[model samples]
Target chain A: MRSFDGVYEGFRAPVSSQKRSLPDSHNPAVNMASVRYISKVVKALLTFDNLIWYSSVKYVLRRCEEMKSGGAKALLSFVRVLVNIGWYAYLIVAVVTIIGIPHLLFRDYLPADKPMPWMEHQPGYTITFSDAVSAEGLASFARYGLVLGLPNLLIMLFILHNLRRLLAAGIENPFTLENARRMRIIGFLLLAGVAAEIGVNLITARFVINNVHIPGATIRANPLPYRGGLFSALLMLIVSEVFKLGVLLQEEHDLTV
Target chain B: MTIAVHLDRLLVERKMSLTELSERVGITIANLSILKTGKARAIRFSTLEAICRELDCQPGDLLEYVEDGEQPS
Candidate 1:
């Protein structure tokens, strides 16, 4: 009886008083109530698998409420920092990619022992050669870095710059026309990136891949942009349109007296 | 845009300034100015009711349909 007190304590009156009224645990109603409460508790515990899950859910909801109140600002600021860091890292990689061009030009004049910093293998292709790979084949590796890398770097820089500005503006007012414009521009840039990727792949396959040969080698390459990029670009465009609608709604809300 | 807000005219007829109307309607002066200038995209029913109650005018009296090429007075 005293142990059952902990189970139904919150829902019912204190254990001593309730037991005094009950007279005996054999009372059918009392027995049923105790069984029902015990079953409910057991069910909840079983549903959660363990006590950790119950406490974890409670903690997460409390944290979520805290974030809803004011933690979102901290999260946004953290995201801004991460975006900037990513842009800086990408710039460094772009610089490395560009370095391959000069190395390709004056590779003999430079140290021959050093490995090429360029992207020698593209994403979609595998090549096998019986004889020695030609100089043209090696040069095409460096050319691959330039053709695809430069456009990608430029597009990413624009996208990141717009995103940085959009976040800064969004902190003040997320549904502003400027934010909508930034979203639209970002969407367009993503589409442009897809176009550039496909174009570069096609041009490379036509001009560079043709020259890149070995005596009895089979070169298999797909001159097509990845579907993921295309999907993302289209998704971004849809998001941009939704952001425009949000901006319009925000304007109407602001004007409402 | 063809539906012109006659809030300024209503305020003028009532001999009430925008600030006075804004205070009477319990709405912000800036929001009243937006409504007055006909720059508001849509008016909420609650806001329109508040404005109408203060101005002692019907919603129709405060808003009028103007022909596309005709200038609102």
Candidate 2:
């Protein structure tokens, strides 16, 4: 399997020599992040590789002014394509899951410690894939789907809305007031999705995972929790604020001319 | 909110059109319009000097600081 830094270093190796040794006043990680952020911004706005963004900001605004305003015609923009693919793939997976879960639950398999037919061979051994379905399995599946799947669906809907806005907007000025508003909405949704997960974990433990006994054993559907979404949501909110500021600046520049 | 540009008066006194002053000062008409309409955020010293040189007026004559009690004319 490929390791993480190997891919990153391949992209950065050529530029590494161009960067000087870090100074005591600056943190290397912070500087690298800023450089990457600014580079991405510049690349998106001007389609240039210039590292000195300060000098090009005015030039970029001028270029934006020169570009004619109208709705974008192409239906397959990067975000739109990616988001469409993701939603469709997720839908297929969800459908399969919906079918598979019920099928698994309804299986008429016996609860026994018998070896598989393959194990009857004197020189061979075999193992069964599952024990009888636990009493709490269906409830666990429902909670998992409710908590994880619902937020994912919401995120897809938000992205679709943003894609529509982008399609309706001019190519020159992709960032509009509507886009900024949607960005903020998406950011809040992301945070809410995290909160929903936490709530689901608690509700699952309390209600869904009732202490129950099967024929011979007890079942406790303990769930593993995650908080990475919280950090990502916070980052999105901050980026939304920056998007708002960019919209304001773009408006001011447009009116100035 | 109190600061005001007296460019219209200065231009009338100098008998010069805004375009003529803008050309002589080498500043864009849009920027000069921004200044004349009191929409400018700040005036650079070099630009102020250029405007003053072309219009034959002092900085005080071109700009005024109106107090809260008085309405700007």
Best by TM-score: 1
Error of 2 at A162 (Å): 3.2
Question: Where in model 1 is the C-alpha error above 4 Å?
Answer: A1-68, A109-132, A135-140, A143-147, A199-220, B1-15, B64-73
Where is model 2 more than 4 Å wrong at Cα?
Answer: A1-148, A163-180, A200-225, A243-257, B69-73
| Chain B TM-score, one value per candidate, order as shown | 0.90, 0.93
> What number of clashing residue pairs does each candidate have, in the order they appear?
0, 0
| lDDT for each residue of candidate 1 in B1-73, tens digit (9 for 90 to 100) | 7999998788889999999887877888888888888888778898989888988889999999999999977
User: Candidates' interface RMSDs, in order?
Assistant: 1.2, 4.6
Clashing pairs in 1: none
TM-scores for every predicted model: 0.59, 0.50
Candidate 2 DockQ vs. native: 0.04
Instruction: Give one digit per residue, the lDDT tens place, for model 1 in A1-257.
Output: 01222322333344346568666676898889989999999998898786788797887676667667877785676678789998898888877777766665544322323332232333354333323344344544555656567888889989998988887775757877777788888889999999998887877676545654433555566877898888888888888889889888887788766
